[model samples]
Target chain A: MCNHGIHIMEEVKVIEIKKSIFEDNDRDADNLRADLKKRGVYLLNLMSAPGSGKTTTLIHTINRLKDKIRISVMEADIDSDVDAIKIKEATGVESIQLHTGGMCHLDAEMTRQGLDNVSIDNTDLVILENVGNLVCPAEFDTGAVRNAMILSVPEGHDKPLKYPLMFSVCDVVVINKIDVMPYFDFDLDKCKEYIHMRNPKATVIPVCAKTGEGIDQFAEWLLNEVRNWQNK
Target chain B: MHELGIVFYIIRDVKKVAEENALKRVVSVVMDIGEVSTIVPEYLTDCWRWAADKEEILKGCQLEINTIPAVTHCDDCGKEYPTVAHGKICPHCGSTRTWLLHGREVEIREIIVPNN
Candidate 1:
């Protein structure tokens, strides 16, 4: 029995490898960012919950900026090409859909695959509409030059306090559905304050996607972002 | 679902390590999962069992998780506290100016392989 135990112990070996699971993904993301920078392609990863007016806001922003900049859109979903069709039909820009095969979020590798299908050389900006989730998407960087998120008024001002990680990572936070703020208890000032609490430098843009109100500001921000990216 | 996605990443990493060492079969994978890492241990292991079995090298590989307790540092009071209980706030001083020092890690500590 002692010989048997020794034999079993000898057959098993433990190797020390203290590495973060996200390390590989993070490295891939950095490499992708460098490649995009070399190509002068600004990839914006837009994330938010489902029904947060991401598609509508994209349509409005694309319509405003398409004339000035060569734009493309990549809509990521578990299943469905509806968003891809909508963006193309509404703005007439090159748009494609990426199905995540029931995955919750798009990692850097998946984003790279999606970018392969788009005309990166001809396009100045590629806005990737990430899977509609506030949790998982924030954890995985999609190698975008910048990260943005939408928070509809109905989702409440307390969202920033709840999903702190999501708010913290986003460079810009677009507060949508502000037109209905009068009916709901969503306080605009409080929402901004909460967002600032989580992320001091996060630019908060409030817009009503349904009425196209305050979309010009968002468009202006995107234009400046794209211009700065190209020049940098 | 999120756990399943993480399992795929783990599998990929382990496979690369196995290839580098010329390991034919992985006996077990040890992980360091933080308290606030947002990964449920139960869900992670369940996902691991399902995904690891599909891979030839990782067939029947055991997944062992070490829970790292989350600790937050208070910038105001210069004290430390448990993050899971206080959560972004310093409980001793009631200050909102706090940051997580650790416990957001989803790391692979090591891998157990057969000797020969």
Candidate 2:
């Protein structure tokens, strides 16, 4: 060891360790998934950037499936509880507000805490409207069985090129605000092509949350996914 | 977007490991960051410096980052290529059946402790 050295040096101990910084979070997410499966709870993570009509869509979705299946929502935000308030007023179902305390995303442990605060004894579906950001939320797995994302018409169709990971990780891509399609010059075919290019297995649904256009298909897909998850 | 939040997670993990191993202090912590990953190394280290100093075990511990190149594996050609340059397409075979092989890592490679 001294051949390449300048002179004699003090002896030192070298310990080799290779561990993932995300190991703990991954393990926690796995445990939470197992626990949710055991309890017959289908958790869906609905993600999108700010002003993507996530709340409005969720309210409509809840109105459609509330009678058939017991549903709850975990509204996560950086500091405000306005979405949770709106959800409670609209759905009247159990809605828990999770403040990330200036954090951009919610991790598995944080989701678990949100779950503990709400009652899931007889709930069939739990939707987690993760913090309204496309970048950070895609990096963390919150133990959700299904991942859904929304992109509004105003955000343009080039979103897939800029944020590829979000599209790749998502199971379904909701192109919200389709009613404004005539005004925005947003080509639905081109956008769908971009999403398919990144994620071939993704289901692209174009909907208008405000006018309730194409929401039936979204509801049907969600119910089918929940049913499949429950059966599995 | 939240490098400080990630730094807190790292500190919590390092603290747990230190406690389990009965380590009083640490010299450095080495990380393997992927090129395609959304994390910014400079932002992470900056956040780490602000957070680690508050904790006793990691007060002056140095943070080292090792960047891992992003690579993609093409199913059609059975070859691997750089993901940043070529993206989801296979450069060798021009196929769209390519998947990422590496460069999404957020790992801790080593934790160096001072001589006893």
Best DockQ goes to which candidate? 1
Question: How accurate locally is residue A104 in candidate 1, as Cα lDDT from 0 to 100?
Answer: 100
lDDT of 1 at A8: 57
Clash-forming residue pairs, model 1: none
Model 2, position B37: C-alpha lDDT score: 82
lDDT of 2 by residue, A1-232 (tens): 2321321142334445577767788889999999999998999999999999999999998999999889999999988889999999998889989999889999999999999987888798999999999998988889999899999999999899899989988999999999888888798999999899888999999999999998888999999988887898
What DockQ does every candidate get?
0.65, 0.49
Identify the candidate with maximal lDDT. 1
Candidate 2 deviant stretches above 4 angstroms: A1-12
Model 1 has how many clashing residue pairs? Answer: 0
Q: Which stretches of candidate 1 lie over 4 Å from their true place?
A: A1-10
* Residue lDDT tens for model 1, A69-135: 9999999999989999999999999999999998999999999999999999999999999999999
